[model samples]
Target: MRIGYFLSSEEYTPAELIEQAKGAERAGFSALWISDHYHPWVDAQGQSAFVWSIIGALSQATTLPITTAVTCPTVRIHPAVIAQAAATSAVLTGGTFRLGVGTGEALNEHIFGDAWPEAEIRLDMLEEAIHIMRELWKGGVVSHHGKHYTVENARVYTLPEQPIEVLISGFGPKAVDLAARIGEGFVSVAPDAEMVQRFRSGGGNSRTCQGGFKAAFATSEEEGARIAYEKWPNAGVPGELSQVLPSPKHFEQASQLVTQDMVKKAFVCGNDPEAHLAMIDTYAKAGFDEIYVANSGPHYQGLFDMYAHSVLPKL
Candidate 1:
């Protein structure tokens, strides 16, 4: 499997993100995955750079391909605007940009005081938004009047030589089916073989499947776990709470129930190259074509060095 680095916009400033992108490229990572968030999950992560602005900077800073580990076009931003931004990004990156989209969390999409749609409704809106974006990318005046959105004589002027590949992120069966039906590729954060098989058998055959996992690098495993829990306790927030929580404070409140061990279980703690390789193998065995690893603390350079010297060489 191809190994890539995931840049956490929620945790890094714009300059930091660009530096990480450059570092990843130098460390021999194959690609990049950057998260799109309007707010840090619990404010301990502490930074949320505008993803498009960072993407523009990243294009100049590095040659590796980049994807928005997921952007939500259904709300917060209109699909039309996202289509234009993505087109410009693709062009800026010399056609190395792939738009990864999903039915977004309420934390980001509910900022306009819009009522959070249920999962089914959000999926429907996502389908419509994907259709509209794809239409706009065709280089014509698109006038879409769908059930959830409307576009009036819209066209994406700045486009790449090819239509930008759209990778859909899905965690459930219904969403996976939709991705299989419409998306050029699939994205997920889990190493679930069943879901990967479901996606392929459901019509995603031969499409790229990307998975990601988080790591917290430190001198010792316990120190790494402490850092992860302090910064990303929400990693242990179970069920639909992650999707439905509307604010950082709300997430902070919910995350109080999450234990440090829970967060540790979710992250690959410490600088053990074997642990990193085991995580990569898990994703590979689950049928992912590519895997992105994200670090959650100040020791990202340590993680990168480990990958370059020990982890990546073995792979």
Candidate 2:
């Protein structure tokens, strides 16, 4: 039941993110989760700093253990390159970093004009990418010609004292099985007991299971919901749309139908400490090893104070 702060890279500047990292540590969070995004989910979110650069800054900014909420290693960037970057990040954080990875979305991967493959194909790519990364992390030159990727004479010269742990993020059964087979841990946004059971049944019982949620802790519920709706209505866009949407503009257009009421239902808006606690309890009860929460608006300090004074202590 460890509680952590989630840094939303899409909404904050790099400097502000570093400050938030430090602030989170100071406010009694046990760890950190940072989203890795090349583009914002919607244009309203307004920012997307390079995640690796932020990781480098975070390694120096806070002692709190950090995880990239998830990074996609299969497309836009080659697996070998991501392996090198992740290895360097592990070293930079003194082994406090865990690499959380996934199959990725069109929003980020489509930038290089690569055709977004079907979900099944993407999973295959992710598995191969993981294998390539693990080999490079073992500290030797490696070469591979796989179905979806080719790595030639790749080696990571600098790595952490400990081997970096890789966590797989997924929501469905097939993906969960893949995580159990290869991942050192698992990650998800929702607290699904069945998913956790599937992981354990597939031999991931001993691995870390992490989840994340959002909160908009403003002075009033209406104000919180309004901000959340304005900034994150895309979150309510259901189904595979999140994975396949090609641009923020498309997302914004789709999210036009998401009302403030939808945001209110999805997020724990307002300054109610009890509501915040209840949201966290859902994840804790689901047996997550770690849970992280991100603010949906500019009032992060208020959220921190609420957690520090009221919410975190109860958990």
Considering every candidate listed, which one attains the maximal TM-score? 1
- Provide the lowest-lDDT 10-residue window in model 2: 257-266
**Per-candidate TM vs. native?**
0.99, 0.98
For 66-166, candidate 2 gives per-residue lDDT tens digits of 99889999998898999999989888888989999999999999998889999999999999999999999999999999999988888889988898899
Model 1: colliding residue pairs: none
lDDT of 1 by residue, 1-315 (tens): 789999999999999999899999999999999999999998899999899999999999999999999999999999999999999999999999999999999999999999999999999999999899989999999998889998998888888998899999999999999999999999999999998999999999999999999999999999999999999999999999999999999999999899999999999999899999999999999999999999999999999999999999998
Give Cα-based local distance difference scores for all models. 0.95, 0.91
Off by over 4 Å in 1: none
Among all candidates shown, the one with the greatest lDDT: 1
- Model 1: lDDT of residue 103: 98
Backbone clashes in candidate 1 total 0
